[model samples]
Target: MEILPRPFDAQPLDGTSTVPKHVQLRESLRSYIVRSGEPGAAIPSERLLGEYFGVARMTVRQAVDCLVAEEVLERVVGLGTFVARAKVDLHMKMTSYTEEMIRRGMVPDARVLSFEQQGASPLVARELQIEIGQPVVRFRRQLLADGEPMSVDENFIPAHRVVGILDDPPPTSLYSVLSEKYGLVMEWGEDTIEATAASPSIARLLNVEMNAPLLKIQRHAYVARAMIDYSVSYYRADRYKLWVPLQRPGVRSPRAYSSKRLG
Candidate 1:
């Protein structure tokens, strides 16, 4: 959670003022959140809030309770309160998994589970723009973030471009490696998202209950004239949410909502 400086122009609460000091403090904080695009953010602790607002800790607790009841913030069992990640706008162009993790201020990581040459099936061949039964580089990983297990990533790259990568698996950002080593800087990709029941593997890796609904992302990434990667990502629905923003070119844009979808 981030804390900006308290504003100086805040009108001090007087005994005769109808609004309570705690309420006024909360309102000021709420406005700061809106302007900073950090709504639902976990603010400072109750003691710190009380100190900043010149109010009692109980008064600060009252304001926090009100906000929590309204679902503006959430408290984890062991972790402190944090911004409730609720928004899921589907219309916007999808970003890379690594990119999304970085945006949320988390360090995304991956463990190479397996890497080897694989024979492409008809469907895989079509997706990678290769012939069936051709040798393709298959790279699989147990994706991680902040040292915790995330979804699994199964990706395929053309064998010719990423030679010997399967033999000498490296521990680093694949995107950065592709850009510097293979000169394959992916510019864009198309992803198809769907709701699917979690597979046994997914349930195990994501630590989710059996048969839980999960978001499946199937993507085909391209670079230069060849297909760079075809990846299938299964995100843990309970621990994850997707947020996107959409707008039309040369047109006035309307407000996008911050809520989750059933899918």
Candidate 2:
């Protein structure tokens, strides 16, 4: 059986418009992909698109190049371009990776890469709020979702807080162990997120190309006034995206304002 290419269902390009043809084609392609609602699906070839839109193949290529650069489409050597996988949206919240993965219906796994006690460096000391030379438990793990590599996490905790952590088996969820065994329930947390390129070591652990874009998150988790956990995590930007909610402050409803005026 032969598989025919899906039809593109966007409005025809306006040849007389002042807007650039590539830009118009790019938007039309974007809209068509959204309406199709399929990930990893192959898009029409440049020749076919050029013929349908009455444009040069080079124009079609330029529009496709823009989408490829934005990661909206990916090209394989022997295969044609495809719609990229939808990135997982990470809502800003105080939740463990395991819990978040479960909420997203993915099986979560963690492979412990390194675990040992180490003297706190200046930066580690400042982040964990411990003495410069104080002992700390340092552990690095490669986090996964459905057996696929997702992120690499390196954690630091005051040795005095988790005294026997090094002796025990590495836990899948550190927060769970802390609350169950040590009575250190996390009350609040602060995360600093930034865009960064993956280093060689991190790229190896996360199974991504070196210098690929990553979301670097530095977290400080607290129990009451004491910081209990500090971790630096690098997430693959191709697989994950940050989602933040926004709201305007001090807005009043028109009905409420009218009632207040009458009162």
Which candidate gets the maximum TM-score versus the true structure?
2
> Which regions in candidate 2 have their CA more than 4 angstroms from the true location?
1-45, 48-72, 75-80, 249-263
Cα lDDT tens digits, model 1, 62-114, are 77677666556566555565555543332324355576677767798877777
lDDT of 2 by residue, 81-153 (tens): 8998768998967778899999999999999998889899999999988889899888899999988899999
Global lDDT scores for all candidate models:
0.69, 0.88
Clashing pairs in 2: none
TM-score of 1: 0.60
Evaluated at residue 233, the lDDT of candidate 2 is 94
Candidate 1: give the clashing pairs: none
Model 1 clashing-pair count: 0
